[model samples]
Target: LFHTLSFFYMLSSFTSSKISYHYHFINIRKNWTEAQRFCREMYTDLATVENAKEMNNLLKSIKDLSYDVYIGLYRSNDFKWHWTLSDSFYNGEIFKNSKHISNNESCAAMDNNWKWFNDNCDSQKQFVCFNGKICY
Candidate 1:
């Protein structure tokens, strides 16, 4: 009886720690900074895609495929990249293969190809947001 109870407790703990995120696509066009502000006020924050799975989920959430959208990634004045959602999972290899990235670009956006690309932060674009609660 003790062993069975222990197994159940462990199972419950595992299930509770598993987090599921919800992605929200906002169609209004705005610059990266404005997009971030809007997301904070309305939903959570700019979308943070940490891995291939989250990237796929983000793509699936968007209803319109007509235009590119801003994401949470941006580089500070010193050129250090960071996500607006500070707790976002970081994937170092995310932009390794992207040929579109240039040294001057600091903001990130999801193009029609569903891949990340560096863009000018001042460019107006639609953006996505995720719930602030981290499931894990």
Candidate 2:
């Protein structure tokens, strides 16, 4: 019985160690591009959503936005939509209901239903930071 308990405890510790909550919140009034640059200066990029869980965490951490906040999704120089911070190409796994406000809108935003929206990168709003990094 003691050996079993010890094994469970070890398992629990191992699991917890693999899981990391590196999210950091930042309230800044800056344009999307500026915010991205700010995040880059901090050694990590903006919030990248690899799944729904990360998306929800980001949404929950952010407050009510009077304006759209810039997310990590954007068009690459190749004219393909890609996450600004992630090496993995988005396979349309998340933000399936996303819509573009206008074709000119380059930055992605989390709108209703945690959907993505393309808006002008110059819009002022609060942005989120994650991956053991923070930016003003």
Candidate 3:
């Protein structure tokens, strides 16, 4: 009976977590900085490409042209790249093949193959917002 109860508890937790994986797509034209702030004001900060699966999910959610979206990764005051969503350092090689180049590309997005690339934050573009909350 203990095993059965534990199994139900695990299932409930997993279901709740699944319901909270909210990565919303917002269609609007705004610079990266403004877009980042907008997301925070509305609910969460700029979204993060948490994983390839989530990235693919976003790509499918996009309806129009995949505009460059502002992510939670950016250059710090010291010029080191970091996640704006949290203090976690960005060790992921998501943008290894970017040709646009340099720290000026303050925004990140998933290109055609679920890869990350940098873009000018000031450039107006549509965005995907991530809110880790259960949507009713």
Q: Count the clashes in each prediction.
A: 0, 0, 0
**Which runs of model 3 end up more than 4 angstroms from their true locations?**
1-20, 77-79, 96-103, 134-136
In candidate 3, what are the lDDT values of residues 12-109, reduced to their tens digit?
21111232445677788788788788888885876654444544565566645454555666755454556566555554334434444565675665
Report the number of the highest-lDDT candidate: 1
- How far out, in Å, is residue 12 in model 1? 26
List the candidate numbers ranked by TM-score, top first: 1, 3, 2
Give TM-scores for every candidate, taking all chains together and pairing residue i with residue i.
0.71, 0.63, 0.64
TM-score quality measure for candidate 3: 0.64
Q: After superposition, how far is residue 33 of candidate 2 from its true place, in Å?
A: 1.6
lDDT of each: 0.68, 0.57, 0.57
Considering lDDT, which of the candidate structures 1 and 3 is the better prediction for this target?
1
Candidate closest to the true structure, highest TM-score:
1
TM-score of 2: 0.63
RMSD of each: 11.1, 11.4, 10.5
